[model samples]
Target: MEENNSFSIKNWNEDDRPREKLLLKGRTALSDTELIAILIGSGSRNESAVSLSQRILASVSNNLSELGRLSIPELMEFKGIGEAKAICIAAAMELGRRRRTGEALERKKITSSNSVFEYVQPIIGELPHEEFWILYLNNSNKIIKSAQLSKGGITGTVVDVRLAFKDALQLGAVGIILAHNHPSGTLKPSQADIQLTKKLKTAGDSLDIKVLDHLIITEKAYFSFADENML
Candidate 1:
């Protein structure tokens, strides 16, 4: 989608815009689109950097994984994405993927929602699309195994409850923690999120496995169903 607005990012309020927001509120405060806009720096004559970045992301169904698969030529096909902009995007996406891969090679214990965020943020926090993951923990709350259950859950309904718990049974995990990232940078749990957490909790109960928590992760913050007494 080509943005018809000719206004620049500068036209927005200093505090409200991506560049200034990052400076004032820190990097974690900006959304995925805003981070991409910062990398590309400027948009074409008819689009703001933010708009061009949004259009680029929209082309990939807002999946950063899809965006990472694009070649420079493929990214350049967009109206405002050029060779330089494409290169910048390509580099950043590569770094993000590498960082996630490196982190996933190790295991971490889940002591709290904040701990879950620290371990999982590099994997999903900055993506343009939603992802659901399950952390299967041994009796001591140490992570023994992890799996990606679903690729899309912006509405919080795409995860399969059976699939999420199947590995817990195989791994002989005593407990499980549910986690998924919100690309929109909102920490509020949707009704679907609540329902999904309840559904999974109910299923885990019959198997004698505990559902410890469900964390809704964002760029900087997270919402914990267990912490809020929602689960």
Candidate 2:
């Protein structure tokens, strides 16, 4: 069934309204467009909220992960999404990401690169820029803290080697896992990436801290330096 674009949801049958649909049929029964319409709240002068949401989802091929990556300004480019509406959408997306990351307790032990991905992916996977993070682990290989060392552009970040070990030394952490996201979606490490890993590992060595692995994270995959014997 095709909806009339010009008609507001107010004019539609109550059953067709996204809010009503969620109430009657439950959340799983609502489409992605309906879920997004609930976030943006309203549409432009000539369009219904549902129609505007459909256009927004269509812009990203209806991939929620892709939609999660859009910057606030990018969302504001939509016809009816002003700063407030765009902020609402971005906030909702972040909540969804955090909900996934909240399961980090289940992965407190750093067993493998895949285990690292499960805990860290939700925090950095969908970002539009670079973020360098360090996961500090006790001698038992359990996480002590995960902190962002630096935030920078798509090309790279300037991570201070001394700062990398500061938290580890304070927390009595003997193991460190380096991680950063690539918004460009490339898994291959640049010379800068490899060099930084080497430099940080050397710095950690002097402190008796083990640089266990360096992971280059993308939205759906990761490259592990330890796994590849590059460490």
Candidate 3:
């Protein structure tokens, strides 16, 4: 007796091809490999898109989760993935990451350092330079708005006290939480940090806006000026 079956992309049936399945059934109906095949676009001269995707995944340890973890540079290490595909993969992952984080933020009120850190950490965690952000708050302590105020180099960061107050006035904010990332990842506030905080606090005092806290963030950690009694 002879038993036979065909499983090549050519034999996947008209409805099962990635393009056809995507158009007819929607992308969710496809497996991880199928989704990756669509991203990969084409295959080697002898291989199909599905086969190339499978090979790429296998090179990353046979798990899509592992493949997802690879940075753009790391993903480009695989054969047949040039700059375009590498950027596509990285962009896709970043979009997914932002979506998940945004969902979490939507469910919570900004009430504590942890909450502010959770929101602002992602916005500034990977910056090569320093970024100063101001989180404006309403009467009940809910967030009114958040804005990046300034950016600077390793030693000298500048924040215009008048400009910061102007934004607070524009937001009609009753209070604010100031934050900046330490590219060096140190939570300790420098003397300059204290000087700037005092200036902003003084400006807020005059304008009847409370300066709630100044948060210093790093990729691995954060610091709160209020928590350390610096405010």
Best-matching candidate per TM-score: 2
TM-score of each: 0.61, 0.86, 0.69
TM-score between model 1 and native: 0.61
lDDT of each: 0.83, 0.89, 0.80
Best by lDDT: 2
User: What digit string (tens of lDDT, one per residue) describes model 1 on residues 23-75?
Assistant: 77899998889999899887777777888888888988998877886889998
Show the lowest summed lDDT stretch of 10 residues, model 2: 6-15
lDDT of 3 by residue, 1-231 (tens): 343566444666432489877887888898877788787787666777788677777787776545656778887787777788888877776786687569656844677888888888777765668999988888988787888888899664788888888988998999999999998878888898899999999889999999999999887589999888888
Backbone clashes in model 1, listed as residue pairs: none
Clash count, predicted structure 2: 0
lDDT of 2 by residue, 1-231 (tens): 767684655576532588877876789998999999988777776887889999999999999998887889999998888999999998998898888898875769988999999898888877888999999999899998999999999788999888878888999999999999999999999999999999998998999999999999999999999999999
In candidate 1, clashing pairs total 0
- Ranking according to TM-score, highest score first: 2, 3, 1
Candidate 3's C-alpha runs over 4 A off are 1-79, 104-108, 154-156
Residue 204 in model 3: lDDT: 93
Between prediction 2 and prediction 3, the one with superior TM-score is 2
